[model samples]
Every structure is written in structure tokens, then in C-alpha cells.
Target: NSVSEYTKLQKEISSKRQSLYTLVESGSGNLTKTAIDKINAIRAEMSALEIKKDKAYKRLKIAKDAYADKIRSIKREELGQFDGRFVPELAIPAGTRYLANIILECKSYFGGPIEMNVWRGVAAYNCGLGRTKEWNGLPYIRETVLYTRDILYNLTRMLELKYAYSTGDSDLIAKTKRKMGV
Candidate 1:
């Protein structure tokens, strides 16, 4: 597939670019006339290769985009189970706090009442309503409010972590870690 081929070509292009840079730096010295000519020849070849690679990459992107659109259309038509308003069930394999945080992050983009399948909302409501008054003597009882906030924050970071990994964003990863106190 052109998608996979493009990925390979991109790697080749990156390597070639680095090689050209190294060759230029090495040729910066005041060497003999013959050495300078050879360096110039190499630069010219690299320049041509760069132009060729760029064209190939543009074509590759167009091809990949077309393929993805086709796939999405097919999926949308086949999955007629929902009115396109179904929220996928998310499990908090990690914890309720982490799940709540992720839900908060998702709500920012979708912008509405984010209905979580988890019982974190109920737990938070109970804590706020003093339903857990009988357990006041417990050490964690005083931290009920703080724990709820942490749950919301951790869930947000977890969602952002997936996005950062897909886009290769180190800055996003760092920001998410800082927010979650990771």
C-alpha cells in the first residue's frame, strides 16, 4: 500500500537530509579545489533528490487521505446501530479517578453533559451530600473532595496521553504529566 510505502520513503528522506547536512559541514573546511568540486557535486545531487522526494510525499499523502476517507464512509454506513449519538463505554481499568479525568478532557471538545458509565459522579455526589458521614473517622474521609478533583484531572491527562503518542508530541506528554502530578 502507498501508505506504508510513504512511511518508508519518509524515513529515507530524513536520512538523506541528515547526510546532506553532515556533508556540507564537513566540506566547510578550506580544502583543495578538487575536494570542493566533489562537495558541490554531492550537494547538487542531494538537492535533486530532495525535490523528487517532496513530490513523492505529496502524492503519497493524497493517496492515503483518499483511502482513509473511503474506509470511514464504509464504517459509518455499516454501523447503523446508533443514531450517531452513542457514547462508547469506557472502563476505568486504572481507577475511578483516572477515568473521571479522561471524561472531563473529552467533554471539553464535545461540549455537553459528559455522561460517564462509571459511578464516579455518584460517589462524588454522595461525598458532597454528606452521605459518607458515618465514615468521617477514616483518614481518607477528609480527602473526599480532593480525591474527586484528582479523578477528574487524571482522566483528562489519560485522554491527552493517547493524542500525544499518536502525534509524537513530547510537549503534550510533559504538560499532561505535570497536570496529573505524574
Candidate 2:
């Protein structure tokens, strides 16, 4: 993991610093040319390691964006209403794809799929919708709610479209009024 890699690099830097300190603390009236060269070499190594860490971080970000784009493209192509209705295909938004990835990660963390309701509820919880207690009665980290609202909003719109098409009603206003007993 990136965190572990970061920790390892940090430890290496600290060890190098300690070694340099020990060399300096020794009872030597003046530093020799060889000692100076060794110190310079350690500093260069640390600088190179820092650069490598930065590059790794950038690569991770790029990979995540690419993965999300791939997910979005796949969902856009494959997702549709299958209620024996001629529902037109719709495009999956980028935000939805990103949230879906997060939901998938969460699902993987908790083992495979259990049930549809469970999956939806967990996905909702992951996206920061309903309270964790109300969803699956599991404690979720507050920080994990970052993308929930956007994902849920986009998903709701998609569902509405699917429902509208399935029922042969293209008018959402009329559907809403009928459902509300207006």
C-alpha cells in the first residue's frame, strides 16, 4: 500500500539522519573529505527518494481517474431497464462511476454480495445518504460519506428515467402528481 511505502521511505530517511548525526557526534576535531562526501551522498539519496514518492503519488491519482472513467464507460454501455419495456439507454455520469467504484471497494471489504437490498443500502451509506444506523445498522466512518450525495442524486435520476420509460410515461410531472395523490 502507498501508506506502507511512505512509512518505509520515512524510516529510511530517519535512519540516514541518525547515522549522519552519529558520525558528526564522534570526537573528530575536523570532518574528513571522505566523511563530507558520505554526508553529501546520503542527502542526494534522500532527495531522490522524495522525488520518487512524489511521482508515485501522481501515478496513483492518474490510475484512479482512469479506473473511474473505465467504470463509467462500462456502466453507460451495460445499464438499462429490463422490465419488458423499450427503454432507451442513458449515459452514466462520472460522479456515479466514481461512487460505484467506492461502493465496490466497500463491498469487497465486507465480502461478496449478500442481497440486493443490502447492497443498495450499503452503497447508499457509503455515498453519505441515510444515516449508517438507519441503513444496515453498521457504524461507518463520517469521512467515507464524501461522494454519497452526488452518487445518490445521479442514481435517483437514472432510476426515475428507467421507471418513466418502463411505465410508458415520458412525463415525469404527471407521474409525480399521480403518485402524490394530486
The model with the greatest TM-score is 1
What residue runs in model 2 are displaced by over 4 Å at the alpha carbon? 57-182
In the range 62-180, model 1's lDDT, one tens digit per residue, is 87667556545665445454333231232233345654664464455335576642233434342432333233311133235466666656656777777767877888778866866
Residue-wise lDDT of candidate 2 within 1-182, one digit each (tens)? 66467556655665676566677778376988988898898878878877876776676667656655655565444544232112223223544565566466546544557433344444454534344434453423332333444555665666766676678665875775466454
- Candidate 2 matches the true fold with a TM-score of 0.31
In model 1, the runs with Cα more than 4 Å from the true position are 4-12, 24-28, 76-182
**Error at 6, model 1, angstroms:** 3.7
What lDDT would each prediction earn against the true structure? 0.54, 0.55
Best by lDDT: 2
